[model samples]
Target: MFIRTENFSQYVRAYPIVTFLLALNIGIFILTWIPGIGNQLLLFGIGDNFLIANGEYWRLVTPMFLHGGLTHLLFNMFSLFIFGPELEKIAGKARFITIYMLAGLFGDVATYFLQSGDYRHLGASGAIFGVFGAFGALVYYTKHVFPQLKQVILPIIVISVVMTFVGTNINVTAHIAGLITGFLIGLSYFNPKNIVSWRKKR
Candidate 1:
């Protein structure tokens, strides 16, 4: 249901990394529709215990790129489309990627520990939550820069957290882990020293 407007080009110029990430996710989703390939891709997704314990550690990274269904893919991609450019502009490409991957890895790790062995999870919700955390951290350090961000992001965060517990299939552990991981990473990236230096330059 999401549609790009004229401003989409501006967003692309401002955040090519985010655009590339979106393209990559969409491309993978298209590939997943190819009958047997979908099954192969799902195998790479995060399974709670037995898969990781058996040494398929790569699942930690791969699940972020796989979606459970079309609706899942669209929802996550829409979120990325909405949030990714702004965060990329703030964090820059390298740091943003680091936050995303680390958040996702930590999310998978948490899910591994918290869920029973039989529980399986997939989708980019964990990493998306990390993006939310990064936005919160940035707003925290640069409160004067974007006073309205706190108002906007807080409700989304609360709703997301609440939704996790509302459904049986939702992986609240991964979401929490991703949020905490991103918050910590954001603290490191947007710490007082950096904030002070930025303020001085401004």
Candidate 2:
């Protein structure tokens, strides 16, 4: 299910939400590199608990589109590109974006609540973890129809959780919170109709 064989046009045509998200993320990351305003952009876009406390509530959503560096941008975007399309396909455009935004937002909110006021973070890791969590839900509900999904997606979920702790400066709170939020959302938001519809299309 994870293998991507589509060419650029086909991929874009089939997965508009993923395509738009990839473009939006890459575009914002590029904007943050513009010489004079780069640092300023990072300052404003990053999720700073202190700023959020001061009523800059947008920080929760903004950080999902911001990245600390090229590697950070690439990693998150790559994760989205690989895993996002399938979910978007199954969930449809509206539900897909809702899952992503909710997952990312809950992660940032968790960080705001759990971290020091001075804590700051930028990346889509929380949202990406949410995507994985949704995948876990999908596997659980569809195991009878697609038994191999457990074997495929479960290892990814486990490895991702382990890697979250292994990395430095990682926001463990955001990742965990986003993951739980996503799983719960997935369980309630996605019905058998959506899954069966996706299967029919495939």
Candidate 3:
């Protein structure tokens, strides 16, 4: 019964955070094809986000919704589709959304601090990478318990991080920095003790 509840994925399946984020990213990406509308959209952007232009301080948050191109959106959403359900299950709906948005926000901040002078960047990779790092916590103490998961999940994160760097046409600094921040968040806040829920074995 406990296993059933733990793995049911109810919150993620019906939650607004998941739908809202996906819709926002896809909507913005579609708008990018509209010629002048794309330019105006980004005229208020900040950092490397599309639609971030002209000191739109809000772009710090909005950039998470923008992507560099179709491939970028696909890759980020795929990562979300894969791992986010687990995170939402782990933290519940409210906490899950907080972490997702927070991670993206932190990723944006990292970009701003590291880069300067209107250097632009965009994508959900930073946020998804946060989820990637958060899952690292699951592997830390459960390696023996779930050897299969340990084997699969860690490599995904490592390979993703590596690919962000070793691959061509990527923002290595933002990717790496976002990963580092994400991992730290997972390590610091993820508590294995929380998983041991009990309702009186008797």
Candidate 4:
């Protein structure tokens, strides 16, 4: 079942970090729409190998907050809204922040090394895929407790991989990099043994 927010105030109280992220992305999207601002936003997006090699290292972090278009922004934000809150709650504020950022950075690194040409990249897909990877890891670690999740997780992973190949202009390497980074982080942090104890305490 999907996690649905009842109201704006209640949603903010439940998922402050997710709320802030959503707001920030939306705010940036609005800004980019303003006259003469789209070009400014492009300056912050991830450039090709030469620009990054020239010491524009900040591109790794900034691209995660930029988007190529309204559809790009909407899809990534929707994914974040859906998967972010539960992972944030499970991972806690600091750890969740770490996973989100590291995944995006790793994705950028992958793109920098693997991708060629003068193409620019932007969007939060890398971090969003990180959330998916984290969820997959949790389902894997807790398979005994939640056996049905495997059935759901495998298909999603497969479809994502397939889509990555089929879709034009897709950053398949970034998605894979983020997924692997997130999976390792999740495997290390989310202990299945602690789940029982946490549940009992609750």
- Model 4 TM-score, all chains together: 0.91
- Cα lDDT tens digits for candidate 4, 19-51: 988998898888888878767777766555678
Query: Which wins on lDDT, candidate 1 or candidate 4?
Result: 4
lDDT of each: 0.79, 0.88, 0.68, 0.80
Candidate 2 lDDT by residue in tens digits, 5-102 = 99999999999988998999998889888997888888888999999999999998999888888988888888899999988888788887888889
User: Model 4 shows how many backbone clashes?
Assistant: 0
What residue pairs are clashing in model 2?
none
Candidate 3 local lDDT, residue 193: 59
The residue ranges of model 1 lying beyond 4 angstroms of the native Cα positions read: 1-9, 46-48, 191-202
Residue-wise C-alpha lDDT for candidate 1, range 51-128, written one tens digit per residue: 888888887778888887898899889988988766665676898888888888889888888888876888788898
Candidate 3 lDDT over residue span 4-58, tens digit each: 2333366445445766677788888888779999877755442553334345568
TM-scores for candidates 1 onward, in order = 0.87, 0.96, 0.80, 0.91
- TM-score leader: 2
Better of 3 and 4 by lDDT: 4
Clash counts for all predictions: 0, 0, 8, 0
Full candidate order by lDDT, most accurate first? 2, 4, 1, 3
Model 3 residue 80 CA deviation in Å: 0.9
Clashing pairs in 3: 42-51, 43-53, 44-52, 44-53, 45-52, 45-53, 48-120, 48-121
